[model samples]
Target: MTRKIIAMAATVICVLGGFTASASSVAQDNPTVKEVKLRAEFYQNELDLLLDKARRGNFADFYQDVVKFAHYGEKYPQYLLGVMLLKGDGVQQDIGQGLVWIRLALEQKNTEWQKVYDSITAKLTKEQLDALEPMYETYKARFGVQAQKMSCNNEKMEASNIRIHQCRKTLVLKEFYSVYEYN
Candidate 1:
């Protein structure tokens, strides 16, 4: 299972090269449905892998997968990671950490993700709530930077395209941005 997750993640990296948008683009702004679809096409397989792992209580690999997925702006794994941490499934049970992960998932623009955050909020204590705020601020800053790592504008890309790729690269990301902004 671990091998499968690693392999799928590697596949995502390979296919990401062909995506029209860069992760950096998504990081700078909200991802369009098209950009999200492009990413989902690349990510779904891996997401399935992680979901299976989480379902079976495979915490260690699931945790690693969640970290990788979090870097990609995926909220599903973040939600699952919250569950795992809350239950101490693979990692130590830590509600504070779980809430932080859930909040991060909710911030990523998924209404479904927000449901999990709301459910958590309904159950937390004042102490947990207190711990969650500062942790959320820290996560927001870090997530903003890491969210773009899932896009295609990393070291693998040609240096020449770095500045100009957003324009010349497939209308995928820019097109996504242009179209997405309207909605």
Candidate 2:
């Protein structure tokens, strides 16, 4: 009886260990790193276009880019879309939706988003800001969690231009000139 009990225990341990190893191997094979890298690359491309439109003061082009990329569910694109709406840059002004995206961006901890937020907020009256408070609170309650806050101050226009140039270089290296192929 003692020998039977020891054999049963050993069999259970071996089965569990095998299961765990298999599970770990499967997870390793399906690594999320490639998906994440692709998303980052896509985002960088969109950001490059946005920076170009912004530098040229072509809000219409910028607005189109915002709508096109916002479909990807990327936080930065959403934030920029909100900024465009809030400032009436390329679309009909809608403060409520704009604030929603701003809050979402904040929740995502995209610090660079703060620059667009600040720019729009500076244009709004105190009454407007007050009106947005409740909506902001609701959004916060739903999705707000502590995230690393990002700052936009001391970010010079020159720095953004440099980034644009770098992005262009990357695109050239990748053999992609236009984000939208003129076919």
Q: Which residue runs does candidate 1 get wrong by more than 4 Å? A: 1-44, 55-57, 108-116, 123-127, 144-183
Candidate 1 has its poorest 10 consecutive residues by lDDT at 174-183
TM-score of each: 0.49, 0.39
Best by lDDT: 1
lDDT of 2 by residue, 6-115 (tens): 34423433443321111211122222221112343665776677767766766776676665544333356566666665556678755556656675656454445555
lDDT of each: 0.51, 0.46
Kindly state the number of residue pairs that clash in model 1: 1
Candidate 1 per-residue lDDT, tens place, 1-183, comes to 333433432343344322222232223333333323344344567768887876787577667778766545555676677666555667865556666777776644455556555654654456546645665655555453243333323232465543321111123453321111111
